[model samples]
Target chain A: MRRVVITGAGTINALGRDVATTLEAMREGRCGISDLKMRDLERLAIRIGGQVHDYVPEDRWNRQQIALYDRFTQFALIAAEEAIQQSGLSFTGKLAARSGVVLGTAGGGLSTSDENYRTVYEEGKNRVHPFIVPKLMNNAAASHVSMEHNLKGPTFTVATACASSNHAMGQAFHMIRSGMSDVMLTGGSEAMLCFGGLKAWEGLRVMSKDACRPFSLNRNGMVQGEGAAMFVFEDYDHAKARGAEILAEVIGFAMTSDAADIVMPSKQGAARAIQGAMTDAQLNSDDVGYINAHGTGTAANDKTECAAVADVFGHHADDLMISSTKSMHGHLIGGTGAVELLACIMALRDGVIAPTIGYEEPDPECALDVVPNEARDAKVDVVLSNAFAFGGLNAVLALRKFA
Target chain B: MTVRDKVIAIIAEQAVLEPSDVTGDSSLEDLGIDSMGLVESIFAIEEAFDISVPFNANDPSESDFDISSVDAIVAAVEKLKAEQA
Candidate 1:
């Protein structure tokens, strides 16, 4: 099997607009959850979120590009620009044909959908925008990335709720391992922090009213976040031959469905994915030193995730450092796993474990060694990133430090 | 109808069984009602009784809603409806 490696990564989340600033924020335990700045705030029950601040699309894109690209797609393109530039890959000839883009997004073009819907219904407008369909489609980000990079190979989108990015990246890793594509422009983007997005989630009542406190005793629910994280995943041999810098090696990936409930998470299903990822990576439970948890801070997800990890790792669960970056970045939903993967990279590459911020009192149910409230320096060779979606879809990825 | 009868009827409707077939101690798992059916059963009970159930599917033990048997569910729902009234 061809080994898959990460060549470059870029992100624009609540933490920072670029990789360097974001990683630095993680190292320092910066909390990005703030009062959401959008119209119709009175209508929303949960108004706080981790929104990307001070993003001026006009600085990077023209007026025409701005009109064509929604907030989510603009984020994808911006992150992709940094990632591809860092990768230094110019697609032409066979390389162009062998490379493609696969992105994950739970709510693609949500801002576009919200704007057009408000225009039609609330404002008494007869007709919506002309490009509404093209702009609001779920595959808009993947399509735009393919067009911009001239990736003629297989291109598609994955929309498996919160696990979208992990499922998409898992598929991309499979393609590279199976010799389908030499490189994949993979990761995800989401802009679900708009009015309609918050309104819909408010109905579910899983949103935190105050702050995101994962694995904490008084935690109410999850806080919604918006942004994108894009990565360049290349074949390891291909990356080494070109002398490109390797970020981290993608060792293994696994996905499992709970087949239990739509909203409730299943412990058995999550455990299966975690154990499966370790088996696929050929790493024992003791070999893993850290984990980026899918700790959404909701009453259901945090405890259930802890139970799953304990079941899978057994005694080693106590030794390994586990943290939920969602406590800092708020839950990014589909784009979350990709951003959480950045934490795993930071753990293995820089010997830093990002802490679960906003943690005050720990719950007895979630008694794992949660690196609470502060970042820690730890030399970990292997790390696992977990993403469990709303529909009980679980995707776990195992990464190793490139020796 | 009594709360027992109504709850049994809802569970039976989900399991494709008659109220007579659903015993007080019959488990939903035995009736072949999957997790989705269980959720739907809870929703129907909530709507019918106009009371919220403290059911957490992640850890059922942590919730107030009991799932050991039909009798347990009926008792919990009755208790909730009484408290609401």
Candidate 2:
């Protein structure tokens, strides 16, 4: 099989609007979770999230594009523009036919549905927007990205909840490695911060009203976040031929399902995915110096993920540095893994490990070098990104620094 | 029904047992109520009493609303009602 490498990366999350600013924020260990700004905020039990502020949609898109795009779709298109621009490869002729886009989004156009539902039920209106269906579709972002970039190959969207991005990116990697595609714009986006979304999540009662402190004994629960992150996955040979700037190499990917619980995570299932990824990459436990944990700040997820890491790495678990960027960016739901993968690439390329901020007290159950509160400088060659979603879906990706 | 009786009724319904079979000292687990059941019971109690119980399913023990026993839940609900009043 041929190898795959990341040629370009772009993101517009709570941390910052692009890759450079996002990595800079990660280096400083900033907290992006704060009081959410939305309509009817007083009705929510949990009002804080990693919301992107100071954004103007009119500044980026025209009237017609705005009509066709939802909030999540807009985020994806913006990030995709930056990614495709950075790659410096314009899809044309044969390249256009061989390239495509695959994105992950659990709540595509959720805000649109929420608003229309309110219009019909609460306001007793018979009419809604004409483009509501197209705007709110789950694959709207992928379709738009493909159309914008002239990609005519295998384009689709994956919706595995929190693990959606990892699964989508994993598919992209496989497609490139197997020569099904030469270049794929792959990532994820989510904008589920609407009133209906928050109300539905509040019923589950796993949300924290204050802060998301992952791996900390005083942790309450996860805080929701909204945004997107996109990447360009290209064939190694094709990229090297064009003299592309490679960010990192996608070495391995593994996905597993617990088939046990719907909400609660399983240690055995998560451990198997991590182990499977390492085996696929042909790397030893000692070679992996960093891990981006799927630490949701909930009591169950943090401890469960720690146990899985310990089970897979054994004694070397103590030497590995693991941190939850969710502590800063909050849980992005389907789009979370894509944003967290940026931290992995940053670790492998820049040697700066992102910190798990808001770490007040270390939990005995999650005893490891969490890199608490402060970013650390660690030279790491290989890293892993873990995404364990609800419904027992687990996806792990292993990456190596391209030499 | 009194606050205690209402609390007992809710817990009993979640456990799928008659209200008479439930007692104030009975724990949720002892009554065969799991985590999801506990969450439903909390919702029922909140709807019946019209009071928001400061409970988080992630860490029930860390919550201010005591869910240790039926008696504890009733006491916490009564206190919340009085404070809200």
CA lDDT of A394 in candidate 1? Answer: 96
Which tens-of-lDDT digit does each residue in A197-302 have in candidate 2?
Answer: 9999999899999999999999999999999999999999999999999999999999999999998899999999999899989999999999999999998999
Number of backbone-clashing residue pairs for each candidate, in the order shown: 0, 0
Instruction: Please tell me which predicted candidate would have the highest lDDT against the true structure.
Output: 2
Which ten-residue region of model 2 chain A has the weakest summed lDDT? A100-109
Model 1 reproduced share of reference interface contacts: 0.05
Label model 2 with its docking quality class. Answer: high
DockQ for all models: 0.12, 0.87
What tens-digit string does per-residue lDDT give for candidate 1 at A5-35? 9998989999999888889999899999999
Measured by DockQ, the strongest candidate is: 2
Looking at model 1, the pairs that clash are none
Each candidate: RMSD: 4.5, 1.1
